[model samples]
Target chain A: MTPETVTLILDIAITISLVVGAVFTLVGSFGLLKLDDAMKRLHAPTKASTLGVGALLLASILGAFARDEPSLQEALIMAFLFVTAPISAQFICKVNLHRRSCMTPPEPSSDSTWATLDTADAGDAPAQHLTPEKG
Target chain B: MSFVDYAIYGAFGAVSLAQLLAMVRLILGPHTADRILALDTMTVNAIGLIVMLGISQGTQIYFEAALIVAMLGFVSTVAYCRFVLRGDIIE
Candidate 1:
């Protein structure tokens, strides 16, 4: 392809992706505030915001490519965010459960139960020793 | 402004609006976890803004800053949750 066509393609890609990313970010943030339950709040930023940032990073990659600068950093950012967002979401969910901050947690399957504050009713035990004792 | 320039402005404005909403959630949170979520969202939004700004300015340095912020945000979120879960981040 001619250089001009390539640049045009990149420009279009950047525009669409950035716009999509920003809108997703806005919606996710809105959900964070508008959702009544803490767990519902968790749903917004973890999933939608991660995707939003990924799209923005993609746009940045295209922008950098168009400008003939290094684009790898944008890819790295996307990888890092994708890898960590879920782990952080898990941490946040655990925090909510441990603190009993949410209204109600989902019921664990019959095979095994979760160890939330309500379920782990043992008194006087320190938080550090929360794991179930081995046989 | 050109259409491309206008697009950049719109993206930045939207990301900024998202950041504002995240901040409001952070302040109005009745639960600590909710606040943490809001903060995490803010961090991601900041990354978006930084990238967009970099695009608008035609620079590359902001990518490093974005990467650093993403790493730090993850670490801090995990630490906060660990504290809430077990009262300490490190055993």
Candidate 2:
């Protein structure tokens, strides 16, 4: 294909991708409005916004490169974003759970059963023994 | 000077509207955690908007500004969440 044709194709692809990205973002925003809880609201934005911005960034890079310019720096921003957004979301969810008295703890399961046992054992053994009371 | 430019502008407008709705949630949220989630969503929308602007204007600086915003948003969310949980922003 000719250079002009190639550039045109790239531009079209980028435009389509960007439009889709925006749609996902708008859905995420609506999710924040509709979801019943903080954690549920958290899921929509991360899942949608991360990919939405990722698509837009990719478009930027492609558009730049198609026009014979450098483009990877935009990709770098996206790279950092993908890595960090989830961790921040996790942090917020964890802290929110801690602050609210009404929050329910996760259901007891075999995976966390040991942790509950450890806590119980610590609490029950209130004796301050210097050397395990002459048993 | 083409359909693509119009498409880009349209995308930007949609995201801006999304951001505004997110702001409503931020302003009127019943709980602190709800507000924080809104803030996080707003930041993500802003980053997307900036990237779209950078594409339309053909400037790389917008990406840099977005990077800064993303970093700050992450730090502040973590700090505020810590404060919420432990009554302090730091240990």
- Top-scoring candidate (TM-score): 1
Clashes of 2: 0
Best by lDDT: 1
Every model: Cα RMSD to truth: 4.9, 8.2
Residues A1-135 of candidate 2 have per-residue lDDT tens digits of 898898789889988988988888888888888887766777888788788888888888887886678669887878888898888887767655544422456657756542322334543333212121110
Backbone clashes in each candidate structure, one number apiece? Answer: 0, 0
Model 1 reproduced share of reference interface contacts: 0.82
Global lDDT scores for all candidate models: 0.83, 0.77
TM-score of chain A of each: 0.79, 0.74
TM-score result, candidate 2: 0.85
TM-score of chain B of 2: 0.94
> Residue B65 lDDT in model 2?
91
TM-score of each: 0.89, 0.85
Candidate 2, which segments miss by more than 4 Å at Cα? A101-103, A110-135
The alpha-carbon deviation from the true structure for residue A45 of candidate 2, after best TM-score superposition, in angstroms, is 0.9
- How much is the lDDT of residue A23 in candidate 2? 88
